[model samples]
Structures are given as C-alpha cells and as structure tokens.
Target: MLEPQPTRSEAAARPELTREMLEMVFDHVENGIYLVDGQGVTLAVNRTYEEMSGFTNVQLVGRRLDEMVGPDNLFSGSASLLVLQRKGPVTATYSTSTGRKLLVKGRPIFGDWGEIRYVINTIWDLTVVQYSQKIDADTARSQMLSEEDIITCSEKMMSVVDLALRVAQTDSTLLLSGESGVGKSLLAKLVHRSSERRAKPLMQINCGAIPESLIESELFGYEPGAFTGADRRGKPGLFEMAQGGTVFLDEISELPLHLQSKLLGVIQDRSFMKIGGREPMTVDVRIIAATNRELMDLVRQGRFREDLFYRLNVVPIKLPPLRERRDDIPLLVRYFADKFNRRHRCYKQLSDELVQRLQSLPWQGNIRELENLVERLIVTTAEEIITPADAQLEPQEPELDPDATLGEMMARQERTIILSAWKKHRTTRRIAAALGISQASAARKLKRALESDIGAENQS
Candidate 1:
C-alpha cells in the first residue's frame, strides 16, 4: 500500500516558531536553551530561561539577538552572531552575567520548506568545572601566557609542573628550587591546592623573615612557662596548625645551620618538642619547601647542613626564570591586567605598543615584577588605554661606538656623564641628586670600577 501523502508545506511550516515561541520553549529548559528566529525574536523560553539571564520577558521577546546581547557583550559588539549568519554554527566558551562560564553553541535550524528559519542555541553551565579548571590553568598561566602554556610546551618545565601536580596529589614532601621570583613559591602553593591535602589548612612561613633568635619557638611553638613572655597556655606551631594539611617553608636556605638539624630531625622522625614540653609531639603533615638560593652553595660555604639540604631537596622541582621563557611575558601581562583591573576597579586596555614594550623590557624581577608593574599601571594610568608612555620606560641614550658592548659602553657613558655633572656640581651629593642614586653607592660602585680598570692596566 502507498504511504500516506507527505504533509503540505504550509501546515508543515507549523507557522515556523517565532523567536517568541522558541523563547517560551527555552524558559522551561533546565539547561540554558533558546531559539532565535530568522528575524531573531525570542519565540519562547521556560521559567529557568529568565532567571539565569538578567533579561526580562518584556526586554527580550521582540528584540534582535544582537541587541539583546547588548553593549557590554563583546560577542555581539564583536559581531559574533554575524559569524552565525555566515558560518551556520558558532560555539564558544564565554563568561555570562553571573561572571560564570557557559558553553554556547549556535546552530541554524530549518523549516519544512528547507529554509533556514531560526538559530537554535544552547548554553551549558561549566561554572564549577570550568572554574576548577581555570584555577589550575590560572596557576599554570600565572607564569606568563606565551610562557604560560609553554610549561606543557617544553619537556623540562612540563616535567617540573607535572611533578608539582603529582606531588600535589600526594601528601609527600615537595622541594621547589629556582632563582629568586622564578615561581618556586607558586609551584609549592599549586602543589598544595592540587593535592589530596587541599581541604586542610595550608600554612606558609618565611624562615628567612624570622630572627635567628626566635626561629626555634616559631617553628615548634612555646608553652606558657617556656619563655620569658610566654602565654599561660601553649600555642601550636605551624606544623600543628597545618595538621592534616601542608606547611610551606620559603627561603629554606635562610634556615640557620643549627636549626636545620632540628628541621631534619622532624623530616626524618616526624617528631618535635614544644619548647618547654618534655614529651615529643608528632603530627602528620606534608611539607613543601622553596628556596631561590642554592642549598648546595650554602653547604659549600659551610653555612648550611648538607644532610638537611639532602632531606629538603627530595622531589626537587625547578622553575625557569622569566628570561628563559620571554614568550610567556604577554600571557603574564594580560593575566596581570585582568587581575589588577579587578583589584583596582579599573579596566585598562593593553595596547600593541605597550605589549611590544613589555616584550622588550628586561624583567630581572621575573613574574612578580611584571605583576607589580601591571598593578601599578592600573593604579596610576589615566586613560583606559595603556601605551608605551603608560609603561614609563626610562630612555637610555645610545653610546658612540656600534661595536662597543652595551653593558660596558652604557656604564662608560653613564660614568662620563656623571663625572661631568660632578665636576659641574662640585659635590658627590649633588652628583647623586642628579643621577638619582644614593651618594654612597654611587661613590662605591664608581671607585670599584675605576680600581678594576687600574688593576687591568697594571697587569697589561
């Protein structure tokens, strides 16, 4: 028997759900779902529809999708919907009104006549998962963007960050070794947060920041009668406070040699005495130590305990400095811009020239320095746009010979210029005032350089 005739196009059209009809359908969807007609009106939406998005039925019903996205939406402003106009489907991860993440997928839907009638779109909330991922990514990105993703891009830094993640997954002790501000502390914190001990308290202390006299009590705590001004009740040390968690020891190289013996004992035996207590107390905790200074160097200098250094250097994770990964600068700068923008309540656009300047500058201070400079720019710059002028880079005059090394010639030129100024001013203090350096340091460096030159001449 012949199949029933195909339904006619007009009735098959089902009047093609107006953007309004689609909106009503979208409103009921637990997930963010919406339909935009060819003319781009909200055909229908469910109750959840209006709740998640800030728009009301009145504001959204008859409006164009582009207009609905409005001024602040970079998507509309950037002509993202126009991409749908040409491409048939557009998908992206975007931040919404709640500052939450959503996966937006835009697809062209057709009528019975095979005419493209509406763009059915769906948004899936990735707020929690994306946020968790972003935290890890943000940490990895904390290094620098160009350099940010590069941690994984390189086999070496990748191994370091990877080992950090692995060590974070366990309650094992982690040691981060690198140059000053090379992100050792960052890797330690990343390990803490990424590990099984994440929910537990994570305490950080700078061994170098405390005075040598007080270091003992600070690490092990004190009983009421233990010290001259001790409280009636004993206070817990960082290890106890970080019970079931992690304690980060920064600048471990600065830990006194004698104190290193005490610390090594704790690592080996997991036991410590509260200053006045006769009994030894033990608590389970993961330790993550960081040091920009080489413990081996301190060991060679006879200033650090070799045994303690060996104990702390277990699972050593080395972070590369910013100069080694200059490509990460742009990534780091933008991250800083976004960060400082939120902190300072200002949005500053990093201009092309400004980015170029950032690329060129000698970031001897590394990631921390770049972040500080970006925060400073956010605080001080007047225009929303950050330019080369916004960076305030100091201009250095070019020296005479092209063949001369910049390191040597710049110093020579600077000295010649400073000497001329000193002769004109007739005082070291006046010369210091002109050059913006402390008079004592200026005199010292100059004297040393002159003496070194004279010694070289004597050898010649």
Candidate 2:
C-alpha cells in the first residue's frame, strides 16, 4: 500500500527537492530553525539548530519537545507548550546548559483543512547581547564608583551624575535638592572634585547642624575678640579659606533669613566681610549648595530667601531617591557589604533572600540607611551569610509612649501607616493612590513622618 499523503507543510519540506539541496539551504542559514509536528514531536532540525541546541539530529528527531527537556538539557522550559496552548506564535527566552541565552520564536502552520500541521521555531543566540549589556553596566558602575563612590545601575542616577559633571565645568552655583540621605552631600563633593578648583580647599558647612547664633561667625570669620569666646588669632571663614575652590553649604534651607541675605551678597559680589573687621575681604569662591527640603516651599513660607534661592539654584540637580532607583540597591548592598567587611575585619555577605528583602524596604533614609544597615549587620552578625530571618531587620523609628496624648498617638499611628504604605508601594504617586490623597499631601506626610521624633524611642 502507498504511504499516506503528506500535508502541504510536510510536502514543502521535500517538494521534489534533493536532500543535498535541503541540507545546503538549511545549513547556510545563520539563525537556528527547527520543525515539529502538531503534537510537538521533533520532525527535523537544521545544522544551525542542532549546533545551537548542542543536540544531534538523531537525539532530537522523533522525540517530543517535552521528552527532550531534562535536568541536563540545553534549554530548560518548552516554548512548544506555549504554541500548543494558543495554537499561535509564541516568543520566549531560554538558557542553555552551556550558559548561553536563546531567544526562541515558535509559529504554527495550519493545514489545508485548518488543522494544525507544523510548528516552526526560530532561535537567536542572545549571549552576545547579554554579555554586551553586562560589560557596559560593569564599566559604567566602575567609573562612577571610582569617581564618586556612587554605585548606581539606574539611568536616573547616571543622568544626574552626567548633569553634575557638565555643571562642574564652570564656577556656576549649583543647587542639589533631594530627600534626606539621598547622597546630596556626596554629589556636592563630586561636583567639587570634578570642577577645575579641585586643587583648592573644599569646605563643607552644615547650616542646620550649627547653632543659629554662631552660623555667622562660622561662615564669616570674626576679628580677634570680635565677640565673647572669640579666637584671639581670628580664623578665616570657609568662604575665605575655600578661595578659588568650592564651598558646599549643606542644609542650606536651614540658614537664617538674615544670613541668607549675607550669602546672597557674597554670591553676587564674590566677597564677604569679616564679622568685626571693617574691610571686605574679596575672595573668588565657587558655591555648591544642597538641601533635602524643597527651597520653593521654604521661600513661600519666608523661611528661605527667594533671591538667595534663585542665585544658588542657577544649576539644579535633583538626585533621585533610593526608592525610585531600586535597581542600584543590589550593587550598593554588595559594595557596602564588602566595604564594612574589610573595615571590620570580618567577611560577611548578604544572602539572596536578605538582599531581596532589603530591596523591598521603603528606604526613606536612602543610601545612608542602607550603608548603616550593612555595616551594622557586618559588625553584629557572626555568620558569613546574612539571611532575612538571621538579620531580623527592623527599620529604626521614634517610639511613642503607651500613655501619650491623643495628638502624639495620632502622629505615631499616622507615621506607621504611611511608612507601611510607602514600603509596599515605592512611589509617591502610588502611595497617594493607596492612601487616597494627592501626591503633594503624600509627600508632606512622608516627610513629616520621617522627621517625627520616632527614633526617640531608643532614648526612652
């Protein structure tokens, strides 16, 4: 008896063509191609496909797609199942036993009667692409880490760095704004270091950390015996000492309204007078100011001088928060872990689970918090692998009294709820949605929560 007539697809495989012609046509193609029956039983594979799969024709043909996949198989899952599920095209990525990544596209061809006839698959090796991306990322991370110790995989942070470097070319006053602990200070230093004034002194003065009355003396040096407890020799101010260099005024928003006017004059005239000296000592100094608080809000509230804000904000860089750049967390974690390990003379690394857990945290304190946690874990934990359970990580916050007033109770509860929601949803927009409030309100609440004396619980 004559053999059953082959379907159109099956006939096209041969189509009165010689085996040599088919082999030449299939083998000459660069991409891998394989064909299977409707039941996903491998019918044939080209030389490229065999080489890609690391399987010979005898090993693949007549075996079902499911049967071909095993623990030791080149590819893990079956794209055939996807095609079978929808009876249509399916595209997926799979890893080979040799560690190469393959992008496979499977398409089904229907017979004359509309029945499934053949499933043709095309595979492209993505190992080159994967390796290229890994290399580029590594190179960028290395350069950034070396220059500024900033470990970031997110494009947002990279863009910020790019902008900062460009702004560093000249003596333009740069204003960096972001959430607290978001590396504003570090970026300020980066700007200073990248600028042409790197040879000169780079002075950092925290406006908020210093006493209100002494801010003036700290900024502009006083004459000998200018006031009570004055230095007899009289020291030069940061602006005077930072001549031809950068003066980073961190927490600039905390500057008093009166001092803001003095700072504005210095920025405009490039000179500032000593507190008790009659002569105005002229000095060329580059100013790079940073504040976690919104200067606009402060200006509107009359807490920050609008003119000074405009002067300092000549070039603004908004450093992205840790939540917005969660992609960098792993890199940061590994860096900090290695850092503290070496510093503490202990070798400790975060387990995969612990890393994932840390990545999921709100990180309101941003990079500083992460660094502290890594160091704390390294110094505290004895084990080499720090797991989630082993770390027993809890965010530090100010505690409330059991018999506190209603206002205190409400503040404590509000902080808790806001932080919890913020943790679950990393974005202010999402947090607003979750809490049924405007994005601005959500941001204000988060800021207030973070500032609340919650860490005071430790003191009690």
Q: Top model by TM-score, which number?
A: 1
| Model 1 per-residue lDDT tens digits across residues 38-77 | 7666665445645655546676666666555532552222
TM-score of each: 0.58, 0.57
Ten residues in sequence with the least summed lDDT for candidate 1: 143-152
- Model 2: per-residue lDDT, tens digit, 240-269? 766777778888988998999999999999
Measured with C-alpha atoms, the lDDT of residue 2 in candidate 2 is: 100
Candidates' C-alpha lDDT: 0.65, 0.76
- So what's the TM-score on candidate 1? 0.58
